[model samples]
Target: MTQTLDITDRTRLRRSHERGHFDRETINAILDAQPMCSVGYVIDMKPYVTPTLQWREGNHVYWHGSSASRALRNSRDAEVCLTVSILDGFVMARSGMHHSVNSRSVMLFGRAFKVEDPAEKHAKLARFVNGLFPGRYEGLREEHAQDLKATTLLGMEIAEGSAKIRTGPPKDEEADYELPIWAGVIPVTTTVGTPEPDPRNLPGVEMPEHIRKFRL
Candidate 1:
């Protein structure tokens, strides 16, 4: 049996309940597929949202940024919202009101904390790089002390979250479906192109397999 989350008032699905999911597997799948996430945090009574790259490990989600960022600094001990999404297709409907999009998204609520451990933070950073490009971390040199110190890593538990997904064609009014209008879905996806090496090169170095076949 799939484990389900307790639906609190804030996390409950008020409408289109069928499209809502609280299962761990569903939530994890969406998070794992997307590397970019928007994090919302409040600083000194002012609201702010910042976009950054993120990675997941177990029930925790981690993101990093320059240590100098005010939002990242304030988020160290504050409750925040993190969201990730992917657009699968566009749903065309006979009526404009019914036009929609097919997408999968996850929303998480938790208090983020700065990762203070040097060794742990280093490993987390490595995971972020290797997650996108397999075996590439081994090719890079060790992180400099100053560089590592300049980076700030934050982590939050996926204790409270929800996933909202929509797929297939648009749902139009019953009478509108019979009208003379073409309706279907236009599929969308993220693709990788050929890798371009840096202009300054020491010798002939071929592109790595991970770079040649990168996909999300």
Candidate 2:
């Protein structure tokens, strides 16, 4: 497939491209690493973007919502863009304009469609649940028919996509070199906190090791 974003002439949109990554491996890594994405599409001539949790299986990404969701219903068979990003740090510089963020982001452009097969939908739902909490699927109660009917699943093939990453310190002006100021990167990270147990649970129930040791 053709690259999502052409990077040959970097100067035209240098900032966006200089930080843009197009390797398939990098793109997939960014996608798999994040569970949420902002989906962009046009609705009745007005553009809208909504953040929702998503999962990736091979070259396809999937997200589900209520069957009544306007965005989900409207996006069927239409072109869409999905973006996932994680801000890793802040680049503090002497100049305000030079200040930037260190981040890893991926943008996917493709056509989306609703999954109609009940068997496929169930499988996809299982994958989504497992992606969030590994091994939880086998323990949880099976989804009911009514529950499946109320939910709508949409899948988008990764026909074209790119991952962009920016890291390290700021790029200050030549003249700013002599300025006396603190310039460096302030690192940021995401961590899982202590899991809260259900108040109604059995008094002696302990937290599962999977939940305690989870990291992504």
For model 2 the local lDDT of residue 207 reads: 76
The residue-by-residue lDDT of candidate 2 on 18-130, one tens digit each, is 35453667778888888889999988888889899889999899988999899898888888888899888898999999998888888877889999999899999999877
- Please give each candidate's TM-score: 0.90, 0.87
Strongest candidate by TM-score: 1
Error of 1 at 202 (Å): 2.3
Which lDDT values do the candidates have, in the order given? 0.83, 0.81
Clash total of candidate 2:
0
List per-candidate RMSD values in Å. 4.2, 4.9
The CA root-mean-square deviation of candidate 1, after full C-alpha superposition on the true structure, stands at 4.2
Q: Where does model 2 exceed 4 Å of error? A: 1-22
